[model samples]
Target: MPDIREENKDIINCVLESMQGFVVTDLDGKIIFLNDRYADILQVDRHEVIGKDVIDVIPGTRMHIVARTGREEMGSLFKLKNGESVLVNRIPVRKNGKIIGVAAFGSLSMLDEMSTVATIQKIGHLSQELNQYKSELNKLRGAKYSLDQIIGNSPNLIKMKELIKKVAQTKSTVLITGETGTGKELVAHAIHQLSTRSHHSFGRLNCAAIPNDLLESELFGYEEGAFTGAKKGGKIGKFELANCGTLLLDEINQMPLYFQSKLLRVIQEKEIERVGGNKPIDIDVRLIFTTNRNLLDMVHQDSFREDLYYRINVMSIEVPPLRTRVDDIPFLVEHFISKINKELGLNITGIDDKVIELFQTYYWPGNIREMENTIERAANLALQGKLTLELFEHFLLRKEKERSRNENEICLETVRFKAEKETIIRVLAQTNANVSMAAKLLKINRSVLYEKIKKYDIRTM
Candidate 1:
C-alpha cells in the first residue's frame, strides 16, 4: 500500500547502499546521514552516530572540513579506525550552486576489499624479491679483502697497514702504485673494507682487461641503440652502479690517452652522460686507481696526461716489493703452506729450515704470486709431513740454468723450437705432406701442424 514516490525512494536508497559505503556531514560537522555499510566500516551503531560530530564518530574524518570548504578529494588514501587503508572520495554537496554538506564515498564493498588485499600481497611479494636481488648483488660487488688478509707483519707491512688505516677515514681519491704481483688490488680492497662506506658496494674494473674501443662504454654505460650490437634497455655504468660506494680501477695506466681526458672530466664533475643520452647523471663514488707503471714518468714522456696524473696522485701509497719485506718470509711461507694444505686436502705439517733459507735468499721477480705457485708445487710433492729442501732444489737449479741460458741467447726455448721444426719437416717428408696423417702421428691438431708447416717453410711436393 506504499505510494509510487515512496517505493522509488526506497529502491534508490537500496541501490546506493549496496554499491558503495558513504557518510554525509552538515556544515556544523554533524553526521546527518550514513548507510549501513558506512556505519559497519566505522564499527559504530548506525542510530547512535546520527547527529554526532563526524570527527568523534570517525577519528580522522575530513567530511566536515570538506562540507565547509566546498572542495573535493578523489582517490585519496584514507586510513580507517582499524588500521585498514581505503581509497575514498570526499565530495561537497551544493544546493542551488551553494555549498551545503559533504559526502565521503569509501571503497568498502566486498569487491574493493578483495582488491585491496590482493594489492597488499603483491607489494609484499615485490619487496621480498627486491631484497633477495640486493643480497646477490652485494655478494658480487662487495669487498672481499680485509686488513688482516694482507698476511705479513714485517716493519714495511706494518707501515703500509698504518697508512691504509689513516687513508680509509677520508673520501679522497687514492692511487696505489706497485710492481706487478705485489698485491696492489689487495690494498685497494683493504681500504674499501675499512672505510665508512664498507656497508655499501665495492666495484672493481680492470682497465687493461677491456679493449680500448669498449672501455668508455664499460665505464660510462650505453643506451639502447647506442651503437651496433649494443645491449637492449641500455646499461648502468660503473659510476652509477657504484653510487655512494667505492670503485677501483685497476691497471689505470692501461687506459687509453684519449679516454683519460673523459675520465678526468667525470672525476672533476662527479657526473656522467651515457652514450646516446644527453642528460648527465650525478654520481657519488669514491675512486681508487692502481697501476704497475710509473704514471709520472708516462706523463713526462707525453704518453699520459699530466693533469690526470696530478689529479689522481692526491694520496698515493707505494706498496713495497716482496724483496724488501723478506724479513716476513717465514710468516708468508707458513701462511702459504697452511693455505695449500687446505686446498689440496693434504696434512703436510710445515716446511724444512733449508727451504725457508732458500726462500729468503731467492730474488722473487714474480713476487707473492710466484711464491704461492712455488709453495703449491712443493706441497704437491711433499711427503712424510714436511716440505724438504730436495722438494725445491731441482726446481731452483733449473730456473738458474734457464736464466743463464737466456742471458747467453741460447735458452731451452730456442732448442725446442729447432727440434720441433726438424721433426715437423721429417714427418711431412715421411707422409708425403698428407697434413692429417702428419698431425695424427705427431699427436697435434691438424691446424697446429699446418701452422708449423707454414712456419718451417717445408715443401709439400
Candidate 2:
C-alpha cells in the first residue's frame, strides 16, 4: 500500500511538470504549489511564487468564478499587467469526493496551440501584413488638400501666400483670423510643416470641443492618483506630447476666460504645471492660434483676455472669405471635383459652361466648404462623362435666388459703392495714402480714382 501511494504521488508530479501551466492553491486560496511552466508563463521563479496568496500574485484570480463555486471552470481569458492575454482553466481538487483545494491549468495560447513562440510569431506576421496593406491604401488616397494646394491669381492672395511662407520659416506665435471654413487649420499645418521643427510632433486642440473642467488636465497631464478614478499610471497630455514641436489652438476665441491666464503663462514662461501637480516642467513649443470670431469684440466684452490676445497675435494673418476672392472660384471648383473623384471613385471630367457661369454668379454664404459639398453631390449623381447644368440646377438656382434676395435687401448698387470705398481706403493705406501710387495699384486713372474716393466717404489714414 505504501509503494502504491508513492507511485501515485510520482505520477501526479509528472503530470503537473508536463502540463503547460499548473498551480495548486489551498481552500483559502494560498498558492501551495506552482509548476515550472506556471512560473515561466509569469516570468517569475516557481519557488518564490509558492506559499504566497494567489490573490497577491495574481489579483485576477480573485475574480475567478471557480473560487466561489467548487465546480470546474474552463476556457477563461485572463489579462496580465504586462498586457499579455492568456487562457485559463480551473478545476476542483478533490479527495474521496471531498473538495480540498483548487488546481488551475492555464495556457497563454488558444486551444490546440503548442508554444508561446509560435503564437507570437504568427501575430507578428499578421501585424506586418496589415501595416503593408494600410500603407498601400494611403498611397492610393493621394494628396487631398493643403495650404499650398490653394491656387489663386489675385494680388491679395499672392501676398497672403508670401506672408504664410515667411511666417512658416519662423517660430513666432501666429494668429489666423477668418470666417468659418476659410482653411485656418490648413494654414496652421502649412506653417508647422515648413518650420525647422517640421520633423517633430504637430499637435492640435480645439478650444471649443473640450469641457472647461477637463481642459486643464487635457493640456497638462496629471500624476497617478491625482483624482478619483485616475489611471494607475500617469498620463501625458497634448502639450507635453507636443514639446519641442508645435501646438495649434483652433477656435482660440472659445477658450474659457479662466484658462486664458494659464495659457498666457505657458506662452510667456515656456513652462507648464500639470493639474494636481506642484512641480513645473519646462517645454519648448511654438504656439499658433486660430479663430473665426472677432477677437477685438470679445476683448471689449471681457470674454477674452486683452493681454493674452496681444501675446498670441504677434503675427496675425487674416484669411479672406471666398466672396472677396471670387476670381479663384474656377481653380477651387476644379480642385474640388478632382478631390471628389479620387475619394468617391467617380470619374467626373468637367462642368458645363452654363453651370460654371451660374456658379460664378451665385454668392457662396458658406464659402468654399459649401462649394465642395455641392460638387461632391453632383459628381456622385452625374453620368461618367461630363457634368451638366441640369445636374446642379437645384443647388445653383437656390443660391441664385438667395443672392438676388440679398442684393434687393441691401441695395446692390449702394453696397458696391461702399465696397469700392473700402477698397480705395485699403489701397491708399497700403501706398501710404498716395493717390498716384494707389491709382496705379488699383489700375485706374488718377482722376477717376480721386472722384470715386470723394464720391464715397473714404478717408485716408
Candidate 3:
C-alpha cells in the first residue's frame, strides 16, 4: 500500500487533463498557468513559462499587444518548433469590470485534444462559481516523463528500468504491477516518452477515482447533449485525444465488469464509438494498465475478466516495493532530499548514516511516495545541521508503537480493512445514512463513499 495521501492525490487530477493547453498572463503579460500540454507544444516547461514574459518565451506573440489594448484576439496561428501550428484565441480576463489577466484558448474544434478550450467558456459562463462545480484541473497533467526521472540504484530498480526501456519500443499493451507509490505512473510516462508516439498527447483516467456511471463517457466520449447534463457541442474521449499517443488506465483492476467488455471491444477493434454516436472513430493508442491488486487472483475469483486480463498482460512488469529494496533507500533519500531542497529553496544536507539505517530497517508500505512525503515532513522540522535520528522521532516513535501493535494487529491487510470499516461506519452513522453528507464530512467523493459503505457491509443506522 502506498501512502494514503499519495493515493488520494489522484482525486486532484482533472478528468480532461492535457486535452487543451492554455496560458494566463497578468495585465503585463507575465505567463501563469501553463498546462503541461501547451508546455510540450511550445517546447518549454511550466517553470520557464510561468512568470516569464510572453514575447521573451514566444517571440512575436501578440498576447502582450492584446493585453495592453484590452481587446480579444481569435484565430491566431502560431508555428511551433515541431512545425505543427496551433490555433489560438486570446481574451481578456475581467475582475469587477477591470481587466486583470489574459487567457489564451487553443481551437478545440481543430485539435483532437480539446482539453483547455472548454475551460475558459465554462469559466465565462459560470464566473467564480466554476470551481464549485468541478475538481481541480490537473496541475501536472499527464506529461511524458523520461526514465531519467526515476531515482534508484538497486538491482531490482535497474532491472525494472531496463525492462521498461525494452518494452517501450513495442506497441504491446503493458500491465504494471506494484504496490501503491511504487512509481508505476512515472514508469508509464517513461515508456511513452521513449516510444514513437512521444510527440502526441498523454491522458490518464483513474479507474477507482471516477464514478462507475461516468467512466464510459469519459473514456469513449459522448455526443452533443448525449445526456441530460452533458456539456454542449459534445466532448472528446481520452482514447480519441490520446489516439496517436498513450492513455494510462491507473488502477485498472477497479474498472467495473460492465465496462470491461466494452473496453475489450474497443481494444480489439482499435476504434471507439461515442456514448450516443453510431459512428466508430479509429484510434491508435498505447495502452498501459496499472494495478496494486493481483489481476490473476481476481481472474481466479471471477472478479476480473479473463480475456481482458490476457489482453493487458501481453507485457507485464512487477516493480519491487521500497521495503524490499533496502539497499536503494539511501540513494532514494538523497535524491528526494535534493529535489525537496530545490523545491522549497532550502539548503538542507542529507540524513546521517544512523537515520539511513533506520530508514533501511523500517517497512515502507507506501513505497517511494511515502518516503518522499516523510522526508519532506522531517526536513520541514529540521532546525540546523544534517537530519539525524532525533529529527525523525515522529517516525521512530511510530515504528516503536507499531511494533507493539504488530502482535495484536497481526495481518496488516486485516487491520487496514477493519480500520476502514470502522471509519466509514462512524462517518455514515454521524451523517444519518446520507451518503452525500457522509462523503462531504469525510472529504471524499460521494460515489467513493457509497462504494466503501457497501464494501464494508455497513447498514444505514
Candidate 4:
C-alpha cells in the first residue's frame, strides 16, 4: 500500500505552514499536525492539543466526519467556542484510493479579511509614493552621519560616544533610549556609520508612524496576492532591504503586544517569512531600536513583552536629556547657527553672551530639535548679523519674563506681614484708635497689637 503520509511529509508540512491557519488529523480524528497561526486562531497552545481529538480541540469542527467519509467540506462557516465564526475548508487525505486523514485550512473572519485588504491597498499606495525617493535613498545609503557630527562635549555625551564606538564593533542588538528629541536617532546613525556594515544600506522605520495592521507587512514584507489589493510582484520589507546592514526601529514602544511576540520570534530565528511566502528568508541585518518611553515600565505594565525587553536590552545606551547636559548648549548653538547661516544665505558671525546665557539657563523642553528651530527662526528674521536676544525677543524673552516674575515673588513672611499690617490699620480705624477695643476685635493682646503697630510704623486715627 502507498503511504502518502510518510512519502511526502516534508513537502506537505511546508505547504501547510505557508497557509494562514491549518490543522491535520489522523484516521482516528486525533490532531497530528498544526501550525502557529492555527493555534493563534484557536487561542490555544499547539503543543497541548497535539494527539487530542479534533472535535475536543476545536469547537464545531467536522474534521473527524470528513476523515471517515473521505468527503471534502469547503467554505464552511465554523463557530468557535468564543462565539466567533470563521471560514474553513476541510479535505480528506488519500493514498491508493483510501482515506487516511483530514486537513482543514481556516481564515480570519470575513470582516477582518476585508479590513486587511483595505490596509494592504493603503500601504500599496504609500509604497508607490515612496518609490520616488528610492533613487535618492540609494545614492545616500550609509551616508547618514559620522560620530564627529554628533556635536556635544559634555561628560555624559563623551561617555555615550565612547560607548557607541565600543558597541559599533559588536554584532549584538542595541537599545537606545531617552526623551523625545534627545538625538537618539543620531546615535543610532553614528553607530551604523562606524560599523563594518557601513558599506551596505541603512534603513529606518518609525514604529509609531505605521498603523498596527500594517507593521508586519512593512517589516517582514509580503508576496504577490498576499491579499486582495496587495502590490504586484510584492514589496520588500526593511529586514530584507537592510540585510547585511543595519535597521533602526524608532519609537518602538508603540508596537502592540501581539506583534511583539511575532517580532521576538524573528529576532530569535534570524529569519523571516513573507506574508504569503512559504520559505523563510535568512537575514543578517544588525538591529538598533530607539524609544522615548521607558520599556521596563511598559514591561511591568504588560504593554511590552518581557522576553523581548531582556532580549534587545543585552546592550543599551541612554542618551542624556538636554536639561541634564546643558553644558552642550553653547556648542550646539554655535553648530546650529553656522548650519542655519549657510542654509539661509546669511552671515551670523556670533551670538550675544546674554542670549547664550539665556539658552544655558532655559529649560529645553524640546531639546536639540527645538534649539535648531529657534536658531533657524531667528536666523530667518536677522538675514545677517550677530544673533541676539532681540531676535528671539518674541519667544525666548518669555524665559526672561518668567525669571523676573520668579525673582519678584513674595515670601510667606512678607505676605503675612502685609496682611497683618493692613488688618491692624483697618481695625484701629474702626475703633477710632481705641487700642484696647481694637486689640479685642483683632483677637490679640493690646500690648502685642501696640508693638505690631509700632513695628509697622502705622499711625492710628
Candidate 5:
C-alpha cells in the first residue's frame, strides 16, 4: 500500500510538469505545493513560493471565490503585474467526497503556442473589418449625389443625373458643352465613377492651356530626338496614359486648328502615331470633351474644323449655368460650407440665413468656380462659430463693382464701333480714286478696309 501511494504521487507530479503553471492551495488559501512551471511563470523560485499564502501571491476576489465555492472556472483573462493579459483555469481538488484544496493552472500572455489560437481569431476579425471598410469606400467613391458632395434639388440637375446614369454603362464619346464654371468636369468625373472604367485611370488635359507647339507632344507621344529638346527616352503622352480608361479634354474648342485634323483621324481610326514615328498604336479609350465655346459657330467662322466638331459631338451633355439653376444656390452653399469646414478643420456649425439670401440674389458670373472660391475665402476669414452676411459684404461689393464696370465697357465699345465705321467710310470717300492716299488716311491696308466695306455692305460712297 505504501509503494502504490508513492507511485501515484510521482504520476501526479509528472502530469503537472507537462501541463502549464499549476498551483495546489489548502482550504485556508495557503499554498501547499506549486509546480516548477508555475514558479517560473511568476518569476520566483519554486522553493520560495512553496508553503506561502496563495492570497499573498495572487491577491484577488477570484481566489476567495475558488476557496469558498469549490467549483471550476475556465479561461478568464486577467492582467498581470507587467501589464500582460493571462488566461487562468481553477479547479477544486477533493478527497473522499470532501474538498481538501484548490488547484489552479495559468498560461502566460506571451507564450507562442497559447497565443496562436488567439492570434488567428484576431486576424480573422481584422480581415472582416477590412472587407467592410473596402465596400464602404467603394460606395463613397462611386456616389453621384449626397448631402455635401453634390448639391442640387432642381429638376434640371436631377435630369442630368439620370442621363449620367443611363450613359455610364456604354463606351461612348461624350461632349460636355456649357458656359464656363458650370461644373462640366464634375459631370465628367461622375460619369467615370459610375462606369466600369472607374477602376482605371481618369486622365485629363486642358487643350487651351497647353501651348500650340507642345500640344501635339502632349496628346500623342514622341520618339527620342523627335524634337530638339525631346527626352532621351521616348515619352508616352496623355492618350496612352488614358488607354483602357477615360480622358477629359477641357476647353476642346481651344485645340489648335492644325492638331484638330490629327485628333479627328485618331478618333476615327481609334489609333495614334507618335511624332516622327511610323507605327500606329491602337487604343481603346473613352473620350470626354468639354467646351464653353460653340464649336458649330467656330466651324462656321473657320476657327474650328467641321469634321472634328461632328466627330467629338457624338453624345452631347449640356451643363446649365448656375444662373439658370438659381434654386440650387442654398444647397450648393451648404455643401460648400461643409467642405470648407472639413478642409480648414473648423467646427463651424452653420451659415447665416441672411448670407444665403444674398447668395440667392447675386448673379454668379463665374458660376460654381466663383462660388467655391468665394466660400473658401470667407471660410478662411470667418470666426470659429459660423459665417455671417457681414463677413461676405466685401466680396459681394467687389463682384458688383466688376459687373458694373463690365456693363459700362460694353456700352463704350458699342459707341466706339459706330464712330470708327463712320470715320473710315468718310476718309475713304474723301481720298477716293487714290488708293495710296486712302490707305495712308485709314492707316490700314486698302485691301483690308475694302474687304470690311464689302463685309459691312459699306460701298465706297
Candidate 6:
C-alpha cells in the first residue's frame, strides 16, 4: 500500500546508509550534499555545511581545484589532519561537453586497525627471517659464550681455560663434564670459537629435553610425507645443519642406548641417513658432548655404552664447582656486578666485605648461574653504589644454615664405615641434597659419591 515514489526514496536512503564516505559538490566548489558516512570521516555534521565552499569546509581539499579544471583526479590518496590516510577516486561529472562537478570516494576511516594488522604480519615475517640467519651469526661470532664471558679468576678456572685453549685447535672429540650450572655449555662454545671450524655453523641438541621417539628424526631429519604431519619439501637435520662445523650434544648420557649405537655410527662414519631415507649424507662436523651426570657411573650401571664413552672421552674437561673455588668469589662478584651495571644502568661499586665473606661461606650448589642471578637481583634493588649486608643477609641465611647444620651433626658414635656413611649423610644434608656439593665437601669425585651412596644404600630423601 506504499506510494512508488516513497518506496524509491526509502531504497535510495538505505543505499546511501551503506555507501560510506560519499560526497557531492557543484562546479564552483560549493558543497551541494554530503552523506553521513562522509561527514563522519571529515569529523563534521552532514547538515551544517551544505552550501559552504568545499575547500573551506575541509581544509587541504583538492576537489575544488579539480572542479576548476573540470578534470578527473582518480585513484588519489589523501591524508587527513587526524593522522589517517585514505585511498580515494575522484571523477568529474559532465553534462554533454561542459564540466559540472567533482566526486570522490574511498575508505576514510578504520585505518588504525588495518595498519595494526599489517604491522603484526610484517613482524612475523621479520622474525622468521631472523631465525633463519641466527645460526650463521653464531658461527661468524666464533662462539655464543666465549672464555672471556666465564667471569672468574680462580686457579681452577684458569686451569680449565688453559685446557680449553689447548684442545680448541685440535680435531679430537671432546667430553665436557661438570655439575649443573658450572658453565659446561659455555666451555663448549669457547672450544668451538678457537677451533679451525669456527667459520662454519654451530648446532646444539639437548638429549634430556627431547622425546625419545623424536630424537633420531630431529638429529637426522626426514623426507616430506615421511610421517603424519611431516613438513612439506622435507627438513634438514642438525648434523647437516652443522656441516663442516661444531655440534654440541648436551646431556649426552641421557641419550637412550638404542640411539647411542646410531650416534656412534655417525661419529665414526662421518655420515648420517635421514629418518625415512637410507641414503648416507656425508658431513664434516666437530663433535662436543656435555654431561652433568657421571657417564662412567652410567656405563657401570649398563645404562650407557662403554665404547661410546671411550670415543667421546678422547679429551675431557671437568670444571670445578664454585664452592671449591672460594678464592675467586670476589672476582666473580665484581665481574657479575660490572656486567649487570651495563645491563641495568646501575653503578653498584661493590658489596661490603661482610657480604663477600658470607658469599664465600655459603655453598653455591647452583654455581655461577645462581651467583649471577643473585647479584642481578641485588643490583636491581640497590639504592646507592654499594650492596650492603642488609640485602645480603636475606639471601645468605638459608645457605649458611645448611653449612652450620652439617657442622653441628657430627656423629659422636664411632662405627668406622657406618660413621663415614653417616658423615656423608651430614654433608649431603648440609649441601641441601646436592650431590656435587656433598662430593666437594667430602673431598671426593662426584662419581665416587654416587658409588658410595649405592654401596651404603644411602637414601637422599
lDDT of 6 by residue, 278-311 (tens): 7999999999999999998888668999899999
- Tell me how many clashing residue pairs each candidate has: 0, 0, 4, 0, 0, 0
- Each candidate structure's TM-score, on Cα atoms with residue i matched to residue i, is 0.59, 0.58, 0.59, 0.58, 0.59, 0.60
For all candidates in order, the CA lDDT equals: 0.85, 0.79, 0.82, 0.84, 0.78, 0.83
Give the lDDT of residue 343 in candidate 2.
82
Error of 5 at 404 (Å): 3.0
lDDT tens per residue, model 1, 160-194: 99999999978999999999889999999999988
Put down candidate 2 lDDT per residue, 204-278, tens digits, no spaces. Answer: 889999999889888998988889977878788878988888888999999999999999999999999877789
Which is superior by TM-score, 4 or 5?
Answer: 5
Q: What is the C-alpha RMSD of each candidate to the true structure, in Å?
A: 23.6, 20.3, 22.9, 23.4, 23.4, 24.4
Off by over 4 Å in 4: 1-138, 397-461
TM-score of 5: 0.59
lDDT per residue, candidate 4, 245-322, as tens digits?
999999889989999998899899999999999999999989999989989767755689989999899889999988
Whole-model lDDT, candidate 5? Answer: 0.78
Location of the lowest summed lDDT over 10 successive residues in candidate 4:
108-117
Number of residue pairs clashing in candidate 2, backbone atoms closer than 3 angstroms, sequence gap of 3 or more or interchain: 0
Score candidate 3 by TM-score against the native. Answer: 0.59
Segments in model 1 whose C-alpha atoms lie over 4 Å from true places = 1-137, 398-461
Tens digit of per-residue lDDT, candidate 5, span 1-461: 37998999899879988666677888888888878765666777778877788877765626546766666777655545444455777878889988888877765444658565586456556767977886675454432432224469788888877888877768889999898898888888888877767756678889979999899889898999898989999799889988887889999998988889999999999999999789999998899999999887677568899888888888888888888788898888878788787888976677888877777777777899999888888777874778887779777798799789879989998898788778777777787746568767877666666656775577764
Worst 10 residues of 2 by lDDT: 137-146
Which is superior by TM-score, 2 or 3? 3
